[model samples]
Target chain A: MALQDKYAELLQTATTLGVGNLASTEQAGVLHVSGTANSTADYDALWALYAKIDPNMASGDLMMNIDIKADAGAQLKVTTDSSNLNIRSTPSTEGEIVGKAAHDEIVTLVEKTDDSWWKIKTADGEEGYAFAQYLSPL
Target chain B: MKLTKLLMVVVVSATMLFVSCKPKDADIKAAVEKALSADPSMSGTTVEVKDGVVTMGGECKDDACKAGCEKIAAGVKGVKSVVNNCTVAPPPPPPPASLSTTIDATKMQQVKDGLKDIAGVTVEFVGDKAVLKGEVTQANRMKIMQMLAAAKVLSDVSGLTDKK
Candidate 1:
């Protein structure tokens, strides 16, 4: 069976979940689907559904590029150079400054708003996105 | 000397027979109940001893508690076998939906981050209160409660399955 047809359930589920900017294509017997889920729960749900359909995710027949917002499961550390990092409300420098993280403070990465910005929350309950450059995986 | 030896043997044998023939139901029941009451798991259990056989019956919080009652019963003196009839209590129902519908998104997110790496647990805002559920140690539960309390958020913590 064609990979696209084989993965119709996943595509239908993504659409049903109201994923934004959804795109799908097939090439070389592989199906690639990309989209942005509004929340981490939605993204995780999609991954779970995918796993149910393809248990090991080993099929290589599909590629997923779903972006999850509000991703609190990731642990990261701030690596700013001798200065604290600002946690902004949005994924932009002009976004409201809701909190700040000291340099080298380990923070929970909540979301990858984009390549340039990451949403993080400190241990004290302050949450906002920081510049991606200053954040490092712990 | 030989007559004294015979008399000693008779006394020892009679004592042994008398001791063996004595019914130990009361002692066995007392010991089993003592053991059960000492264990927190067997809180609501009751034991009956009849002819060296034990019958345990009551409600336990879970299967482990039910099994613990049987083990305590079997270990009692003169208990030849245990007839376990304890029933495991069903898990309490989830909190009322009113408890979850009014959660503050920002505070809920904060609670989630504060409890990183703790498995099988979730916290959410319920109106002005934060409700915690799933597996969490008492120490961690108190810690989380303190953090939220300091945050000026009231919290109701329950459904804590203490880690084994």
Candidate 2:
């Protein structure tokens, strides 16, 4: 309840922003909140609020498992810093590098393999899994 | 004989007028429904009236809402009493524990893969925690934390420094 009180504003904001499947629970002194934000902007806003509330998020008392809402066939932008994003044969770095999408290039999402990886197809028709962190849904 | 007959007719007419003045069961039901509808939370409640007594059915979000519906129905005009048949909905189940305290091989590799693109950051597996040491910009710092959270990797970023 104390952790809930501490992150009440963050939870309230998430609800106000219409986050889908918003769920929160406290376990073993940590508050775990998970949901899907309607857009990347909403996701960023929630993260910003979280950082502001926790100050560099050093407390480690909250695990926000929110992700941006993106479906198959949605457009995603490569967010790597001036480097090409790797497309792998599988949803891991252990997978061979099958292709690459240049920084800031738009790609089509084929499926979300997991929270950490998404299967995406480049405009040239090359398709494979990529680290979801470097892809922002458009 | 004519006077007696006229008196009987007058008595019958008075009784009919009194009965008409009393509100009908259907009218009481409508009024109770209208009163409950004033509260959006009471939308799930259904109202019925018999002999001016209102019977509320359907689901309520909680006990407070159930009690509230009864109060509102009782306050309505022509309502003799209220029978709250509304049931409180059960709370949603809590989410499963997500943070994996122990670091396995796959989790370690995930941590490494997440940090591969971020320069200057190195990871060491110390017991269950991923001890991160290096300098990162604020934006990258957030990205690192988000990636770690997504992978459910417990981290000790205290060794990590802020890059100017």
Candidate 3:
């Protein structure tokens, strides 16, 4: 409950932003929150608020698992920090690098394979799984 | 004229007797509700009675509860029949696990892959915890945390310092 009090503003902001399936639970001294943000901007706003509330996020008392809402055939933007994002044969990086989607490129989502990986197809017809961390739903 | 007055009195008494013999719709509704209240699962059900016919409304936890409510209402005194209009509620979704405690090889590789692009940061898996030590910008720091969370990997970023 104390963790709930500490992050009340974050929870309020999430509700205000209309995050879908929002849920929160406190366990083992850490507050775990999971939901799907309506858009990438909303997701970024929540993370920004989290950082502000916990400076440098040093306390480690919260685990926010919010992700952007995207469905099959939805447009996704490649957000790699300059280099082309790797499209692998499988969800893990251990899989072969089958293709690549350039930074800031738009691709179509085939499916959300898992929390960390998504199967995507680029304009050039290259299709494979990529890290979801670098793909923002548009 | 006296015979005509006696005939009017007989007709009035007969009507009174017929009305008193049957229970009122309101009384039947109360009885049905009382019976339904015996089961906690039927708490959401609502009862309405018109002409001794009971109509069950609202949500029931499942089909069994809906049928049970209808049977209970039909058994009530003076209820001619029951119209079970109660809807069955969908089962609640399973709660999401708060954290993934296992640190399998795949999870460890995922942590390594997430850190590959970010320079100056190195990670070591100590027990189930991913201990990260290095300097990272504010944006990268957030990215690191999000990546770890997506992989469901518990981490120790206390050793990570802000890159000025």
Which candidate gets the maximum TM-score versus the true structure?
3
Task: Arrange candidates by TM-score, descending.
Answer: 3, 2, 1
Each model's lDDT: 0.68, 0.87, 0.88
Across A1-138, the per-residue lDDT of candidate 1 in tens digits comes to 887677889889889998877777675454656666776568657877765786434354555655544345667778665688889887665589899999889899877764446778899999988776566654
State the TM-score, rounded to 2 decimals, of chain A in model 3. Answer: 0.97
Clash pairs of candidate 2? none
User: B49, model 3: CA deviation in Å?
Assistant: 2.8
TM-score of 1: 0.32
The number of the candidate with the highest DockQ is: 3
Clashing pairs in 3: none
Candidate 2 per-residue lDDT over residues A22-66, each given as its tens digit: 888887677888888999999999999988998877777888888
User: lDDT for model 2, on a 0 to 1 scale?
Assistant: 0.87
Q: lDDT score of model 1?
A: 0.68
- In the range A30-137, model 3's lDDT, one tens digit per residue, is 788888899999998999999999888777788887878999999999999899999999888778999999999999999999777899999999999999889999
Q: Is candidate 1 or candidate 3 better by TM-score?
A: 3
All candidates: TM-score of chain A: 0.55, 0.97, 0.97
Between candidates 1 and 3, the lDDT winner: 3
lDDT at residue B147 of model 2 (Cα atoms) = 89
